[model samples]
Structures are given as structure tokens and as C-alpha cells.
Target: MINLFHFVLILTLIVVVISVAKIKDLLSAVILFAVYNLIMSLLWQQMRAPDVAITEAALGAGVTTVLLVAAISKTGRLEK
Candidate 1:
């Protein structure tokens, strides 16, 4: 049986993925991508993969989000 916590995490991941794709603003999409990475990290941890979770949290949510945000700052936020 699927637990409520895992189900919620999975559901939130799906929502974030859709939001990232549907969002028009570059920064907003980056933020949503970071949120998606965070939820994925949590799910990985729940699956008993601490190393993968840590790597995803650090690289995906941390470095990648910062880099994307910086890129967006250099360019434009809107799609045009």
C-alpha cells in the first residue's frame, strides 16, 4: 500500500514538473525546477538512496538552480 507521505510527494513532483513546463517566466520556471529537484531528492531518500538524494539536493537544487537563475538574470525573464 502506498503511504500518504509518499503519495503526496509524488503528486507534488508531478505538479511541479507541469508547472515548470507551463510557466512562461524564466525565473519562475527555474524556481519550479528547483522545487522539482527538491521533491525528487526527498523521494530518493525515502527510497533508501541517501547518496543520490544528497547529490540531487546539492547539484540539482543548489548549483543548477543558481546557474539557471544567473543565466536568466543576464537575459530576459519573459518568453517574449
Candidate 2:
């Protein structure tokens, strides 16, 4: 069961990565990248690395998303 969960997590990460790469909109791509981080964090927790998982969830999923959005906002192209 655990192995299956990890497999799914990795698969999700791959799919998100592909989507992020192919997406035309920078903002949407950034959000998809954040989702990728969240999936990896779940995988970390499954591996019993709670500390690392928490960090990834907070920094990768949360902080990175904020930073990306802020950067995009500064560009003014994000409005479209």
C-alpha cells in the first residue's frame, strides 16, 4: 500500500512537471509547480520524514508559490 502511494505521488509529480513545462501562462505554471511540491511533501511524509515533509509543505508549496506570484505580479503580464 505504501509503495503504491509513493508510486502515485511520483507519477503526480511527473505529470505536474510536464504540465508546468507545457503551460503557456507563467502564473498557472507556477501554481502547478507548487502542486508538484505538495505531492512530493506527501511522499516524504509517507517515507516517515515528517520534518522534511513539513518543511517542503511550508517552504516549497507555500513560500515558493508566494514568491512566484509576487514575481509574476511585478511583470504586469500576469494580468492577462
Score each candidate by Cα lDDT: 0.94, 0.88
lDDT of 2 by residue, 1-80 (tens): 55776788888889999998888889898889999999989988988899999999999999999998999888864435
Write out the backbone clash pairs for model 2: none
Against the true structure, whose TM-score is highest? Answer: 1
Over 4 Å off in model 2, which ranges? 76-80
User: What is the alpha-carbon lDDT of model 1 when measured against the actual structure?
Assistant: 0.94
For model 1, residues 2-62, the per-residue Cα lDDT tens digits are: 7999999999999999999898988889989999999999999999999999999999999
lDDT of 2 at 53: 98
lDDT score at residue 52, model 1, on the 0-100 scale: 100
Model 1 TM-score, all chains together: 0.96
Q: What residue runs in model 1 are displaced by over 4 Å at the alpha carbon?
A: none
